[model samples]
Target: MESHPPAGGHSVRTRSQHQRRKRIVQAAAALASRGGVEAMQMRTVAERAGVALGTLYRYFPSKMDLVVAVVGEEIDLLESSIERRPPGASTPASRAVDVLMRATRGLMREPELADALIRSLIMAEVQTPFGDRMTGLLLRVSAEGLTLEQASEEQRDLAGSLASVWVQELLEMLRGRRTYDQIQRRIETAAARLLAGI
Candidate 1:
């Protein structure tokens, strides 16, 4: 006899798994938005997600994992905004500035939640699968912010690299290491440097 999955078993399992994960991520995001990373209790997440406590643990082994997941979701949301620029948004350097400025404005509006998520992302090194995804999203979003007609492939790559550096610089500014105007100037300068002559 050949071994085979039962009828609809694999598809059903995959869909249910996806739904469960979505539920958990949404619940965790809601809690974090309301009270930051400190409020994201695994038991509370499990309850809110309608999954058993053990299932929540299986999905996210610790608070850090859950926090990282929440941050990843936020990054996804940020990408949408970054990609939505006006047609008049020309100049690769200026577009790069626009993307970073939008992200900065968002974090400023939600200071507490930003603090929690940024800290979690920095500290999350154990089994961190989300870091690469975050970087990839940032790169793609940065790339989208530029005008393909005006930018060469090299310029686009440089713009993406500058975008990543801008995120780290923003984190530093958030930590009170530098004044707002100083970081703004630095980001603008860096953006111009990366896409010089464009």
Candidate 2:
């Protein structure tokens, strides 16, 4: 499938344009936080952001795009937080578990928003720009947690696998197929098993 550019070919070349895009994303996030994906109508987001509907479309071509952008924003915040306070566990596996657990707890606190973001991610096409960005962010963050310095190829592979498990566990939690305790135990077990030799 041919992947569409996230902004539908629109580029932010000025501070005003950047701010406008920010507002649209912020509005979308607020709505999702409150009422999940169903509440994030494009027109409603525009009204909330105080931007024209057309302007919102220019920045985010579709509701999925907007939701993905909001998820990106959330991950960006998580990345910054991790950078400020790297996981303190001595082993790579324990540290990765710490980071994943932190992420799980944070998202669970905003169940509606987490549901919206995960739904968008699951709906995204394979190899799409949004999918790629989200995957990259997850891998990078997980790898960073594994090692504050540059991670080796083995470490990176472990991080990728652990990240995949974490996402699937989160989906199960969203579906009520797994409790929070189950999700945490599964993630911890997966991380320990995957990173056993590292």
Residue pairs of candidate 1 with colliding backbone atoms: none
* lDDT against the true structure, each candidate: 0.68, 0.75
- Tens-place lDDT per residue, model 2, 107-186, is 99999999999878778752344433333444454444334236677666666677778888899898889888998899
On residues 138-189, what C-alpha lDDT tens digit does candidate 1 reach at each position? 3344455335345566754675567567768867877888666777898888
Score candidate 1 by lDDT: 0.68
Error of 1 at 171 (Å): 1.8
Candidate 2 positional error at 154, Å = 4.5
Weakest 10 consecutive residues of candidate 2 by summed lDDT: 126-135
Could you tell me which 10 consecutive residues in candidate 1 have the lowest summed lDDT? Answer: 3-12
Residue 108, model 1, lDDT: 72
Task: Tell how far residue 188 is off in model 2, in angstroms.
Answer: 1.5
Q: Estimate each model's TM-score.
A: 0.70, 0.83
